[model samples]
Target: MKLLARLRRAFGASRAAPDGPAPAQDLRLRRAAIPVMAQGTNAWPALHALPIEMLPVVDRPLIHYAVTEALSAGIEELVFIVDRGKRALDEQLDLEVDMLPRGVRAHFVRHNAAQGVGQALLAARHLLDDEACAVLLPGQVTEARPTVLAQLVAQFQRTPGSIFAVEPATPQMTMGSEGLLETAAGDLRLASIRRVATSLDHRPPADARLWSPVGRCILTRAVFDNLEQMADAQSPHTGDLRDVIEAVLRTEPAFSYRYSGRCFDCASPLRWLEANLVQALEHPQLAGEFQHLLRQTAQFVPVNEDLSQAQARALPTGAAAVTGRPRLRLVRS
Candidate 1:
């Protein structure tokens, strides 16, 4: 295991040129507008009370994961779609204002009422301006590679249509949800977004492609139009993006890209635990420090182990066990 770790480190240390072709002369396809949907009414107060700015999957905040994903995907501007009374979110943004990347502008849209996700997106329509495409992320932590967003962006650029980030849903995973998908001409179509309460009288086609939409999507400005049409067409549902996407899928040629990563629904305690574990394992830097701390905690006296007994003693104060156990708490006198 140690040898494998050393080999992995050696390979990671060797840098490679950036992916994709040289920058086009125009250097601009369509400026990406990212809108992070964060509704105050639905947010768990306890989760909200926890410093979301400091809430880490591994050591990075949940919001940071989404923002970083967008920025890495060449998104030019970010607009956070929040609801009124969400002062916590505002404070978080202020606290991390200095950490924002240079040249990337940030904006916020606060909906006056607890509207639907479509309404929240509609609230930020002014920010869209002439942006041909936009990326919308549900403000929650998910385990995905940085290239996940990049891949979606590339697909959008090539197709100039709405793209949804999805994962293949097996029978085990689709227990509580409908798994009906239709494919034609290499494009995946969402047939229905039904609940378990509804009877599945219409089963999916035998050769139907199976994909479950994660809460992230790359959409064209047409989404804004769709939202408006949806609002006028039906009553709002406290910012449910699923409804909006369903409406759009009926009218537009929505495509799906199968993302290869685990996703965490951090709104629940169970999912949050899963997120932390997955992130800790995937984060290279954190894993390295953790392994080193474990060796010290075990009193491994090797030539390469630089920490003295005194230093090792202090390391336990902050280190969690490798066996998925919580850190030992020391009550102060």
Candidate 2:
């Protein structure tokens, strides 16, 4: 009964009852700010080799996936944190202006220096004026149903505090990488992150959850203050955002939602190929057309065999299975 009551309240069904009475004002409409960060000069080097127009996943550029995810979550505005000399990306965005939904605005803020994630976020501080919450989508390709941003936004509505979307990391996932988190308070407080070789000796508790900070994060305005403090304290490194998040975890009530999905680091060649393959499979129209073309081409010639007997070998398997019919099988027996 208690579990059922909790479920009812979670879905807002309990509030509709006559005896329950309406709850306070709906907090769902708290305007959301989305920042898509892509500042590193070597962020996606593989893409540089490919033609600008052709360097895309399915019909859209890889960055479009992040933008689409944010837009799907009802984000009113988008701020792109780009690095200097990213004119190609800006040109691509201008050419594809039609992709933007009506009433949705897009802003591009360039980082003049090769600063870290925290500094890039600080560059866009002007756009986040008066917004109750903001979402930071670091330039990484992630595939999830219901959209990770949408899930984060819903969590923000439920608990109006800083929230981050995390993915549990396995031994294989953290083999060569840093930023392994150790948590206490039932995974509420991140005690520390394993960033160096010497730190691996300190193992996390068995009951302790090991979470990796996925690129997507939803935070309250308090995060801006944290960023400001971090900027003053550190000389700036690659894990600038990580430092800010760890600091916030110590001082404020930071929460995280575990997301079930794989994130692709486009900075690597292997992951980029995987991301493209996944996108190709997920794209409806493009996949359908590609499959159709393959089938049509297969009708005239076998994809692997010689053209001499291609037609005879390419017949439908069902037709060849008819027992009474003359079967065409090039057999050695």
Candidate 3:
């Protein structure tokens, strides 16, 4: 448990909130939007040539989890909002499309180099028309039996406007997270939110409480309308998706579900590495090996001991059999 706790924090694992109420009716959202503009990726050299979404978790790409979570939540159509400079995203989509299930549809559309996520979504408004849909961001991945989006979709039959996956902003995580001011709903894990303060906000509310908006959110036509209106105004400060959602919250009833699942945000290279390490601990084939590696403590090899024995005891399973890497040598110290 201590090892897991350490790794979870290392990877930015989200805190669980109370579970939302059950589905009032059968709500199967058919469409989902995956925005891949890859904003602010230049800071990390790994993303300079490779698409961030295509970055691998354990045995699968970041996009793989997004697609699986959408599919598991009953989304039949997937729209990828791409940018002109993202040819790698297109090629990855080409490979991803063929791998999708027969009935699942994957299509990519370009935004006119939009300013933020809200604007990127407006570019594909025609495809979705006026229906409730799910949105998944690639850099954030969550593991739950009923995927995070599925949980939101199940509750959509009642709320039907917008629902966001949210987590408790514990004291340890309050410093850098985006803040939200929320009023609690009837359910312990559900809340009604009207304000969202993004990092771009220069003057955020003084009392704004932090509730990190996990990358997964459910959207409706009202959200699109708000985005369109905001776009038409041609405001220089076209805010991100959180702004559009906050607008929707003002008029319609939107919920923030404190999902019971664990989420990992791979927003940076260091965090991405942590995500891989944490996920591999639970991976079917890698868990035992990872645990074995974690349990090992540093020790010096005896001068006369067999080198193979030292390698087997100190290195991870596969690493012990590799070549060309440095080996431990005892100089009778």
Candidate 4:
């Protein structure tokens, strides 16, 4: 609720920004920012740092998906915004990033006393340079041919603007998520993004139209000015990407591009598990075994028991489940 109030206060400021976002020009996105810092106030203390950055979506940590998506979009530089206490993410990246292309480079920016997504992006302002930068939240992993980032970049290239890669979603999905966009009809791919919801949105999805962003967007350097200008209007700590987007919309006309991909957001706990299971089921080598395990686990699961508890019971007592273990064979009838 506090977040919603802050978002309202941010937009309610009587004074409007003096300028629009980086003149929606033909700005090339040469870098991508993957802020590993927190978003909103939802804390998952159990999973230190963010679950998406540390935990695995498959054979690699979840951050890999976002990075690969950025690379697929032709981004040569990747900047990781990290908080002081979250060195584990850096160490994990260190161990895994050795396989990246030699031409590609990785850099880190410390998000000092980060409060919200606004501050996280602000910390990386210097590295953003004068051109546009793709902000790829590791949580929003998309399984697509050109990739979610690439799709947004393509739109940005054709019609330069702060590209918000949006997707069709239900009211519940928009709740506690990023601000909802109210767009005016335009081309099939791009629409005039007019406003950002000041409060939690509960709107119905429509005809594959863009209702909300999928945690992937190409933000211009001018957004940094928008963020700074907004600081005086509201509590800087409460300001987030939504507030900055609203600021952008106020002075200039931004566009929302309906991405050609399915984004799996791990920002929500339920979605995190869903992304993992769904992606794992899609893995060629592990699919058959995982499906077999699902079949076995489903048949004997207790109706009233907790699912986690049921899974625990399904495993062999005092040992792991052994494949092809000898069992009693029924004789005759």
Q: Say which candidate scores most in lDDT.
A: 3
Question: Ranking under TM-score, best-scoring first?
Answer: 3, 4, 2, 1
Candidate 1: how large is its RMSD? 14.9
What global local distance difference test value does model 3 have?
0.72
Error of 4 at 62 (Å): 1.8
Candidate 2: tens digits of C-alpha lDDT, residues 1-333: 999989888886633567776667554533443343333434366545442222466567766677677777887777766655656766766654468878877777777545666677678888764555455554467888887777777777777766667766677656655555554425443233322221334566665556667777665566677778877887454532465465456557776677657777665667777887777768876777666654666555556765445534555575543334343443321
Prediction 1 global C-alpha lDDT = 0.59
Give the CA lDDT, 0 to 100, for residue 325 in model 4: 36
Give all TM-scores, in the order shown. Answer: 0.67, 0.68, 0.73, 0.72
lDDT of each: 0.59, 0.61, 0.72, 0.70
* lDDT tens readout by residue for model 4, 179-258: 77777544567888767763344342353243677778887767788777676567445423576577576567777888
Q: Report the Cα lDDT for residue 314, model 3.
A: 61
Which residue runs of candidate 1 sit more than 4 Å off their true CA positions?
1-55, 171-202, 236-240, 292-333
**Which digits, one per residue and each the tens of the lDDT, describe model 1 over residues 1-333?**
998789879877444459845544332333444344443323466555453333567676677777766677787677876555656667766655557777877887777545656676778788774555555554456656655767677666666666667766566545655323344323443223222111134455564555666667766667777678778877554433455566556666777677656677676566777888767766777877665555555554445644443334445566743343334432221
Q: How many backbone clashes does candidate 4 have?
A: 0
lDDT per residue (tens digit) for residues 247-280 in model 3: 5764687777788887887756667777888789
> What is the lDDT for 323 in model 2?
35
**Candidate number achieving the greatest TM-score relative to the actual structure:** 3
